[model samples]
Structure formats: structure tokens, C-alpha cells
Target: MTTTRSLVVPLPDTTATCQARRRLDELVKPVGSLGRLEELAAWLCGAHGTVPPRPLDDVRVAVFAGDHGVSAAPPGAPGVSAYPRELTAAMVRVFQAGTSGVTVLAREVGARVRVLDIAVDAELDDVARDVVARKVRRGSGAIDVEDALTPGEAEQAFSVGRAVADEEVDAGADLLIPGDMGIGNSTVAAALVGASLGLPAHRVVGTGTGVDETGHAHKVAVVERALHRVEGRVADPFDRLTALGSACAAATAGFLVQAAVRSTPVVLDGVFSLAAALVARDIAPDAARWWLAGHRSTEPAQSVALTALGLEPILDLGLRLGEGSGAVQAVPVLRAARAVLADMGSLADLT
Candidate 1:
């Protein structure tokens, strides 16, 4: 005869639990002591919400494209407004053509690309039936003098992103990839990232589209001035986003919140995506846990944002292009993680 006693033990920290087991195995001889690979495997387990995460059925990429008003002020031939507005439409075509490196790579992995027109300047014609249409505004206001977007516009963008994520989750997408395609968008990302870290633009800014030294310097100065302008203001996530963010950033932040609530993973690309992730995390801390930094970008603010969030990038290919390319690159790594847990032989089986 046996008697059972009622007892409760709190669950171990998911992150630690997964890591400890892998580290223990790696400590053994022969198969063990393979450097940090084992440690990394364990970390992946926690990020996947499993002692050993397995293959997900479907992977989808959501690219949120928009334009920036600051482009209007750039001292140049085409002018800021002329450049971003037309380029936004062209990039959308590149995405639609399935010719972009990101689109092609994702297709190779059987991942679907869902392009969302969060705030592009041009109208998309003959779009693939699959792309998501969610334009909030044509472009943002110049940050050199005024707020990027009104509070109401920011809220609307967020709402659209949430709705898209909810709909995708309902359609069986377990993981989401949020990318952006907007000219002069990096300026907006720099502003938001700078504000979050309380750093001036000179530190957070980076070259976009191979800018000349003078133009690059000018961009940095713009970021610095924007930071000073917003000083002592409300640091609230939504407020901060509206005042300084591109439509793409605002929308991605909202999508991240929905991803957390749905327990779906988000693969983030570049500085803008990282900034949006940070803002979304502020809205919902659990969302940070759901994020996987797909890669490090050439942008300086990206590393800072990743560091502040305590996230390690899955890949460090130094990718600066932000068409969801990084996310597509990480899909294989995620799949490999699932394979290790689900298919790798147990010690007993090997014996």
C-alpha cells in the first residue's frame, strides 16, 4: 500500500532550467565540452518556451514599410519627400516581385512573406493576394522641427498592427517576422532608440544607403537635435513612439504586443525593428521574452537596443538591409533547434 501527499513546487525559471540541463550534458567527456554551442542550445530551448522546442509548422514574415517626412529637409537633388515617396513604392514592388533577397531566402525555407503597407507613400497596384494592406499614413512629419506623428495617428498604427497579428495567429502562424521598408526610416529609428536609451543622436546614428560623409554627419546632428527637443517629455511608450517614430515602427510595436499575448515568437531585423521591439516590450514586458534578435545591423543603435533588452542575436552576418532578410536567415537556426530536441537520440538510445 502507498499513500500520496499533496505538495506543490514552483516551476524553475524557464530560461535557467533549459540551460542547466544542456550544460550538464556538455560537461561530460567526449560529447561534452564543445564550447558555447551547448550553452546556446539550452538558451534556445527557453526562448522557444520548451525544455526542448520542436519544429513549428509554418513561418511567416511581416514587413511594415513606411516613409519619413525628414526626407523632405535633406539638402539634396531629389529632395527628401521626392526620394522616400517614390522609393517606398519601388521597394514594395521589389517585395512583390519576390525578387528581394529576403523574399527569395524566405521562399527557400518555405516561409511566407506578408508585406504590410503600414505607412507607405505610394499605392500598391496588382499586389499579390497574400500581402497585408495596412496603411496608417502616407509618411511621418519631419523630426527636425515638429513631432513625427500625432498621438492619434500613432494609436491607429498600433491598432492596425495588432489586428494583423491577431488575424495571422488565427490563421495558424505560430511565429511572426516584422520588417520595414521605408526611405529615411533609419532617422526615425535613431530618434526612438536614442530616446529610449537617453543617448544623443551622434552616438546612435548610422549611415543609410551609403550616404556621403557630410550627409551622414548631418543625419547625426538631426538625431541629436530631435533628442534635445523631446527632453523632459513623457517617456510613455505610445507617446514616445508617436512623437518620434515612423509609421512602420509604431505598427511593429503593436504587432509585438499581439505576438506576446498569442505566445508567438517574433524575429526582429535591423535598428528600426529593434526599436519597435523595445517599445513593444515597454507596452508588454512578456513580449521581450517572445523576441529573437535575428541579426546585428550596420546601424549603431541596433546593438545598443539589443544590449538594453538583454537579447543575443542568432546571427551576426552584419546585415544592414532591413527587408526581413535577417529573419529569413534565422529560420534555419530555429528549425535546427527544434530538430535537436525532437530527433536527437537520448543517452539510453545511443547506448
Candidate 2:
């Protein structure tokens, strides 16, 4: 596996991207007729460092599961997620049993699914054996009152992500999908997005897991408090993540950075993944070159992150599922994009 003591994001192959764009124009379809698919094909070429990219046959989805200390709040308490913290561990079991939405969609798209136990708060015996263990901590601290992680713990989480990316790439994964499963993670995501993009907490916060108006208001307040606590102290992306992001977000960012360094493409899920991507982009500005936004999550923070990253989502089905379900839904679209480049005849050949 490739090791990076500190993440060094690599630049994409622009020459390959140009070559692929020319090839797309020469296809039987009119120039730009295929819209985003053509762009996706060209992007694939850039990411793979080839004119006509290989099929994304070796696709893998890594769902990093953790818990947020903020989730420890009772249902009626401020900053609580709609679901209990135990749901984090329970959902890992669901993923392990191949019963989750991500599992079904990965199966549909011929992608392999691996659940990573990043930092779930509870002890999970049955699901523990099936997951890739890389727990950075028991769970992240409540950001509303304190830093989510110490700088060292944040770095450790980032290293965990980078290691996961290296392992997947070395194991023959050409394409990666990042998913997150941590109750109250959206709160963390909102805080990170708000801090990174200079947006207000109210604008970034959303009703995670179908929170009612009262819960939504409470979440927003929590995010505002977190942002206030970290104001003027987030000197860089790493600091921002350490201050406001969850363990899962830090790991996801690290995973994304390493994937780009290895020249592997990644499909990003919802707001949590986007929050991580924002931090990764700050760490390595060129890392965005390897990522494709899989969908537009209903979460407001997702839009902020996508806008900041300049990524247009392939799907916009109002999806807010966090277990990489939205990214899995986008796999078929990427496969179809690849097919357009691989199977379509050139205009000359058609004539």
C-alpha cells in the first residue's frame, strides 16, 4: 500500500483529458450531445491517465461508520440526531448483512462494499468481525462545546482514510465511492461546511434523519455554537476539520486525498462526504480532480460544498441517505458514460 506521512494531492492528466474530449467529439453523436456523460468520460480519462479510460469494473464502496458525541443527547435535547447513537453500530450490522440501501445498490451496480469501523461509540461484536477496523477513537467529541478531535486524533483519522484508499487501490479498485454512517454526522457536516465556506450555520444546517422543526432549529443552534467556538482558530483545512468535523469526515477526506494521489477516481456521496472533500481540497487543492459528485443531497450543506468544489451532481433525487446510497445510485450513470466512449463508433467508422 502507498503511504503518505502527510497527504500530497496529485494533479490530473490534462493532456489525457484533452485527448478524451477530442475522441468524444469524433463519436457518431453530435458534439456535446451526450452532455455530462461526455464530460464524465473525459474526466475518467484524466483520472486514469489514458485517452479512452478502462471500464470501471473494479468499483468499491467504503462506508465509514462512526458516532458523534453530540448524538449522545436525548431525543428532546438540543443537537440530537433523530436516531440514537446505537444506530451507528446497528447500521454497520445492516451493511454487513447486505440489507442496507447501499448494499442493494452496490449489488445492482456490480460494486463491492466494505464497511469500515472508524469510530463507532458502542461495542459491536457481530459486525466488528466483518468490517475493516480503523477506529481513531471511541467517537468524536461534541463540537458544540469543544473541538471534535484533537489535532493528533484528527491526523490519525486522516491516516486511517489514506490507508484505506491505498489498500483499495492496491487491491485492484479503479473507482471508489465514499459513504458515511454516523448519527448526528450531518450536524458535523453542516458545521464544517459553514466554517469552510463562510456560510451561516442556519443556512447549512438541515433536518437530518427527518428531524422536526424543533429538532432542526436545535441542530442549527448547535452548529452555530460550534462554529463560534472555532472562529478565527481554523488556520487551515486540517484545523477546520479538527475543530468542527467528525472522525468519519476526517477519515473520508484522507481517503479521498490518497485516492487522488494514486490516480484512482472517487464518487462522493452526500453532505458528509462533501464536507470531507472540502477539507481534502484544502489539504490538496488538486484532489478535486479525481472526484465526481454522485448526487445533490437534500441537505443544504451539500449544495454549499458542491458549489465550493465546482462539482455538478449527476443525480438530484432529493436523496439524503448517508450510507453512500446516493453515490451507489450514480454507479450506473458512470458505467453508461464509460460505455459511450468504449462502444460507440467514430463518425468516420459509422460512415
Candidate 3:
């Protein structure tokens, strides 16, 4: 766990006069045509309480996983047919081995990967090493049957997530990557997003790990039923997350809230992760100020969710892969942003 003591100083105006002047002199034609990135650099200069744009160094990805009780639906979930909660635990172990698809790519980019078992049926193998096992419950209630998570479970999930973020910050993590790995999480993700954004179930749902058309339609129907079950209190994001969210979304929301308070950067993955980010943003709109959309997911609701957050995805790549793969893939682009600000020579010297 990483913790840094913060000394709040009266807001100081740290202007990038030299940097702006150099940009103005550059041959790019416009003073700041790159929009958000240019603004981001300027904002970073001010937020640094100094100049020269020192970028964040310690980057970590927190991938939270859980099992959805609703995954047991028959005739619809024709694939596994049994409880998939064990599969969630299995994937957590795979991620812990540092050889999983995501960990391999994450290691390449120097990003430390950590897995959180928010809720699952089976206990993980190596409990102490790197996997965070803060189980909220065995699994969420069946979506079509009842509330996914009770209010207490929802709050507990969020508290655990916040504790994780606080610990990560204490351990020197400068930037946070919030991701998820529950087997049937996409179902809960779509239900939550659809309810929050008031989109139709058909519009919000998508295939998770390759389901047939019948399964896809059934997924939408289940989400629609969940929406009906948890209606009337749309004002509270936490309420929405708890009632409709997976443990992963609850955890991710917790991380986003803590990062916003600490003034750390958060890289958001696709719709599932971003739905949690949205929950955080709703609670504290300022939290969004620290968000960077990592990539555009092939999930249908992803673009709508990202646009709703006012974040532009850095990469499209036609990627629907979860388990933080897309977000890890975009790390180099963020590193590139830092390199441009830190290493690129100003036009004054070039001329």
C-alpha cells in the first residue's frame, strides 16, 4: 500500500508561459489544436504547484473480479450451464501467475497488476501474495430474481475498494487502472449502465465471452427485468451500483472516488469499468477531472458511456477484450504523452 502525505497550499498560479510561447512558435499552425491533451499539459503545470510538467511514475492496475448469481439462468446461459463462480476464481489465479494474457502485456509496459476477489464461490489458491481477497459475499443475487447486491453488500464492496486505493496510493502508485474479471460481469455491467443512462436493454447489452443470439437476447431480457426490479431511486449512484452493479463496478467506483480526492490520475477501461467511474463521478463530479479514457470497447454501450463521461478514447483497436487488456495496451500512449511534455524540445531551441 502506498500513502503520500499531502500538504495543502493556497492555490498558486503556475503558468506555463514558456511552454505556451514555444507551442505558439511551433509549425503545427495552431496554438493548441490537440484539445484535451494540450489542455491536460497546461492543467498539469498548474496542478503540479510548479512547472516543467513532472509526470506520474508509479502506475498500477487493480482488476476486481466476482461472480454473478444470475449467471445460472437456464435456457439462456446455454454455454456453461453450471455455476461460473469457480471460473472467476480460476481466472484470478491465472492472473496471479503473471503469465495471463493481461499480466504479460501489463508487465511489458511496466504496469504492476493486482487482482481483487470482491466476491466469488471458491477461495483463491495463494491468498497472501498479490491477489486481494476482500469478498463482499459469495456472489450477487440472481439479476432477474432480486437485487444484485443488498445495500450493505454494496457499501462494503465500495469500502473495500477505497481501502485498496488508499493502500495503493500509500505504496506510491501515482496512476490507477481500474478493471474487472467476473465471468458474467458483462450482464451486470449492462444492466447498471442501462438503468443509469436510461437506455433500452437491447441497446445496452452485448455478448460476453461469445454467446449465441438467443443468449444475447436473453441477456437483454434479464437486464430489463433487473431494471424494473430496481427502479424509482435513480438519484443515488451507490444505490444503483449496489442494486444493479457487480462487485467489480462497486470496487472500481471506490477507486475512482479515492483517486479524485488524492488528485491522482485514473485510466478507465470499457463500459463495465466506466460505469463504476460514472458512479464515482455522480457522487463527486470533480472526480471526473482526473479520468483518462483508455480505449473504446466493442461493447455497444461503451461509446455511449464514454461520451457520457466526456472522455475521448485513445485507442479503438476493435477491442472488446476485458481483464484490463485494452487499458494495459493504451499505457504506452499515456507514456508517450509524458514523453512529449518532458523530452520534446521547444521551438525556441529548434529555430
List the candidates' TM-scores in order.
Answer: 0.87, 0.95, 0.87
Candidate 1 lDDT, 1-351, residue by residue in tens? 000111111222486545646644633244654444454456556655566654666888888888788776534543322244467778888888888878998888888887888777766657654443577777788887888887688778887778788888899886788878888877888889999888888878888665767678878877777788888783888788877887788888888777766667778888888988878877766667667788888889998999999988889997888888887888787776555555566565455
lDDT tens per residue, model 3, 35-99: 55655555455444444456666779888888888777444345311235557888878887787
lDDT of model number 3: 0.72
Report the number of the highest-lDDT candidate: 2
lDDT-best of 2 and 3: 2
Name model 2 segments beyond 4 Å from true.
1-6, 75-79, 130-132
CA-lDDT, candidates in order:
0.74, 0.86, 0.72
Model 1: colliding residue pairs:
71-80
- TM-score: which candidate is best? 2
The candidate 3 region of ten consecutive residues with least summed lDDT is: 1-10
